[model samples]
Target: MSANTTSFKHVSYLWDEAEAAKLAGDEVALLIYRSNLLGADLRLTNYGGGNTSCKAMAKDPLTGKEVEIMWIKGSGGDIGTLKKSGLAALYVDRLRALRNIYRGIEHEDEMVELFNHCIYDLNSKAPSIDTPLHGFLPFKHIDHLHPDAAIAIAAAKDGEKITQELFGGTIGWVPWQKPGFDLGLQLKECLDKNPGIRGIMLGSHGLFTWGDTAYESYINTLEVIERCADYLEQNYGKKGPVFGGQKVQSLIKADRLSKAAEIAPILRGFCSSERSMVGHFTDDDRVLEFINSNDLDRLAPMGTSCPDHFLRTKISPLVLDLAKDEDLSDVKAVKEKLAPAFDAYRKMYTDYYNTCKHDNSPAIRDANPVIIIYPGVGMFSFSKDKQTARVAAEFYTNAINVMKGAEAVSEYTSLPRQEAFNIEYWLLEEAKLQRMPKPKALSGRVALITGSAGGIGKAIARKFVEEGACVILNDMNAERLAEAAEEFKKDFGKDAYATAELDVTNQPQIEVAMKAAALSFGGVDIIVNNAGLSISKSIEDHSQKDWDLLYDVLVKGQFLVTQAATAVMKKQGMGGDIINIVSKNALVSGPNNAGYGSAKAAQLHLSRLNAAELGADGIRVNVVNPDAVISDSNIWAGGWAEGRAKAYGITVDELPAYYAKRTLLNKIILPADIANACFALTGGLLSKSTGNMINVDGGVAMAFAR
Candidate 1:
């Protein structure tokens, strides 16, 4: 089945009567439940791209009496995971009073402030911009959404006639207007003129449905969307020759683009800004089908599928031509092709901004394309981090589907360019952008940590993320890596990090991981060679296999991953840091630890060599030598702790105390201590230091530098 056909179905009312009965008196609880049901379905709305509201009776703050109030989704909150705090409560009468002063409100900024002033409680969050439209309607519940199927119908040239035909005058149609007090008033007027309508469709915008209860409004939304989906399927489901049987061309498959991995980094580097690292997403089959179509060049640049998407995707995407036979891996070819294309794209963006922006408009956003359409390879989405890029990709992916459905029925149309500009440069959106928190120290940087499932490596990964760096976790254990990624997501957002299951000693896998890091998070800013295994054996008893195993992981693996990462750093023309998590054994060896000490010593020397050779490229190589960090450490697992405890003539539980008392400072070393040293070296705190080994052993005399 086609992508559109697979998702087409009758409306499924997800309301559970038992659950609703439990929340009978709690309108907010019922509202959240129904909102989640609508938001969870991508067919209904994109992430955080819809609003819902319900009118209920609540005690007034000023007067000790109950009054009618409206609880609506707040700005910047996702409906799928919305909570009580995500909905801002407003006094219904106070919000409705804005219509009296609506004629006097001249600026959008004033309108936004007036809406904020209508909050029922002083501590409540700022209500959504569309709250006025929700409050003005006479219904007790309302939902406004940009469903793909509904969008396809609303964006068509004959959208009004289609709405009338499908709903039989049950749905009112309003012409496109910039959303604010004026548009809300227009919607109120439209409903008054057309009595008994179940919903309203904003031209080139989306759908709005209302009823006496949350379930009624939600089902109305679902039924309207299903009707649009059914209309498209019934009228345009058949395949036929259009344009006088010119033999329409098919798009190239993604698998045919062998060099997508290599080209991803180049495109990322080309699109990056001074303050932002450009994360990338290589297209899947659906995207490849859309970008490779015969009508791509014409349809792609016309406009976005929805006006709200213009802020994320821009008015149009940047189009590039990649020949099938070109070697994308070649540095010279990538530079020659991408450099000029990026320059032209920037120029076009500047021209558009200059032509559309008014004196009162906020400053133009950065002149960079959010979406990139490549003819041969596929398409890509660029953003400061992975999550934002994913959201843009999701919207554009849906856009392709909507465009296809619209084209199948009638010509696909978008709001005029000026209308798009009005929303894109609106003061309210600009305020939202300005409200973002300041960038952290390592913002827009990518760090890769080997053996990141536990211990020092994991600690380092967490530190990087805390400082606003996108971390890529690598471990041989896939299960541990997945768990670590999920744990990190709880603190940092899901897009702040990525994971790869990798055996550092595998050369092929090392190369793939390097490319994956670059593709997933633009390019590498830091590389931590922290993956190693410890073995204890006498010199006479140590086998060649044991020695080789240590060397392959501790020495050889570091060399391979570093070499690959350095190449990408060079391509990006950005300096980087290479930190090796060596052991104190490198400086002072213990008995029966020959293999481990020898490999670590070799890695320490290799780091100095890399530092000497790569200094000209601004890449700093440093070493963090830590010793006896047993807490939450994986290296001490599998009888190693017991063996060490036996050697020290102490119980396993007291082994930590024994080591702590041995140091001059009588302090125990922890993984976080080593991580802090690593962070200090790489985060420009010790910018002038390189090829230097910093100790985290709480005063190890034997391991001290001369």
Candidate 2:
């Protein structure tokens, strides 16, 4: 099924008015309620990426004296899912004291500790990263969100103009600033300038609204977003292309298992951690064309839904259209082609940052896109968690809709590149970077890998960390799963990953893993279906059990993982990448491995099918077919190779030579080789390619079944 590209509708959240009213009189509860309502309205703050606060008088537990305290959203709690425990009660005096101290730390290692100390309530979970800002606000109730609608208008050419038009003189507009102290200062200045203003508009960022009551605060936010949405509709006229029930592509069976194994460790990291991740799946060419558009020169830098969204969806989408148009329809080949464009885009981004630094010193986000949208296809957003993805998707779709509208007029003109850079590298934006250290490549991004505890799956997880991705490592072996996690840390560093002990073949486990990954990483962006089990017996000797085992891990597991990941990706709206590790066996028939070969063949076709169906969502699903390269360490351990060599009437030494001579490269293929292919498929370089399969095996085309 195609993703939901339909325009948004106003539907009330599962908000309990009576419950909210119950918190009205109590200052602390009122603040929590306001935050809850605010988050419910804007997908951006859903699980609580944002925070809320109220400064009120409360008796100190230590002393009889009453003092002002701020009740703020607790750390790591989704504002939409908040409870009393989700709030931190920090002393206003202490908070104010910290405000007076200049933030001395700049680098992340120094900042995370300082941020940790900034918390006011130890009993409460970690405080919101915006605690300092919350402390600065004078209002009794403050609500902040990476609102989808507001961001849509804010990240555009005339965002300020639109804000001015929508709220008239009542709203305060601040250019993007980093969130903590810098944003707090900016917010304070705005509040100081307009004491009666109901809300604040962050340029290329989010929306902050305050009121005397929770309902009032929520209503104001609702009014603002609605106004912006209405303005967009009137200006742009909403309607996207309708897919006429075209059959979308999916991954093949054998490729699926191999990919599952490869992506498992990363998936485990995300699922086991509190963070969540989501991924998109598709390999449609038209969709890729949209993503890799050179038109970015005329448009603004597309980002996650808002500033906070960066934590979920990184900074840019990996354009994937090149796969469809390339001569070799393979993940690796297309990635090579896309490198120049991606580098160009990065260089351009750096130039823009330089221009916008206005100050001699400036902070810049890494040259990675959090949301990836393939034109004429779809888009995907990655986050450490699901809430982040949901918010990103909402804003991204709306922004794209508006951009489409602008295109209809003349050409879509977003904020100037420099202006986008200003927001992207704002101090408030910078403050968020201070709180948590980024993992390797896919750090904030989510990954799902099957059979991650062993062999190639484990290797892929390690590689992703080196590049900065939070992974959900999955495997059926509980003992191996623990061992892999330890091995990853030992190889990479302390706290290098997360893991889940799951049988990828079971749809239930796959679904659970998907949700868990989202919660762990905030959202998923990459899926590597790299789990597989081989049967050595020939076709006549192959039992149904063997067929089922091979098919379950190789084909069905991929489908289940992709299916779940795609749901989260579509909601996130930034698009996603799915990589399938298939075998050259799909291309060449082999003895004693017919069941495995048949499964691999089906998997190859399936990858293409997924690409077609999910293309509209900007998902890129690709396959990597590797020739025989002895992946199963267990096989070597069990003397299976020696036994097979005897059966083939060849010495064991000759077997290795036999496989090597068959390939053009004449090189030994390692797990790292396949890992490289998977990397190219999901990273920003191959942003435009999808549904293509590249052969990694030595020149053996003996199984050319496609």
Candidate 1: which stretches are off by over 4 Å?
Answer: 1-12, 237-258, 489-493, 638-654, 684-689
Q: Give a tens-digit lDDT track for model 2, residues 1-706.
A: 1112232344243446778677666877766666656566544443445677777887776686888877777766677777878777777777666655555434322332454554455677666557766677777777777655566666666667766767776888888655555667678888899777878888766678877666666666666666665665565423332121222332343442333322322322222223334433222343333343545323335544354444443444455343222243243443456556556656765775676685634456555344554333344454443334455655444444445434432234344445455456655446655776654445556677787887787777777877777677778888888887787768765334557778876877776676556434445678888887666666577789988877887888778878878866664555788888888877776567777788888898999999999999889999988765576443344444765575577887787777787677687777787888788777667789998887777666564445
Give residue 95's lDDT in candidate 1 (0 to 100). 86
Give residue 438's lDDT in candidate 2 (0 to 100): 53
> How far is 86's C-alpha from truth in model 1 (Å)?
0.9
lDDT of each model, Cα atoms only? 0.81, 0.62
Index of the highest-lDDT prediction:
1
Instruction: Go through the candidates in order and give the C-alpha RMSD of each one to the true structure.
Output: 3.4, 14.8
* TM-score of candidate 1 to 2 decimals: 0.93
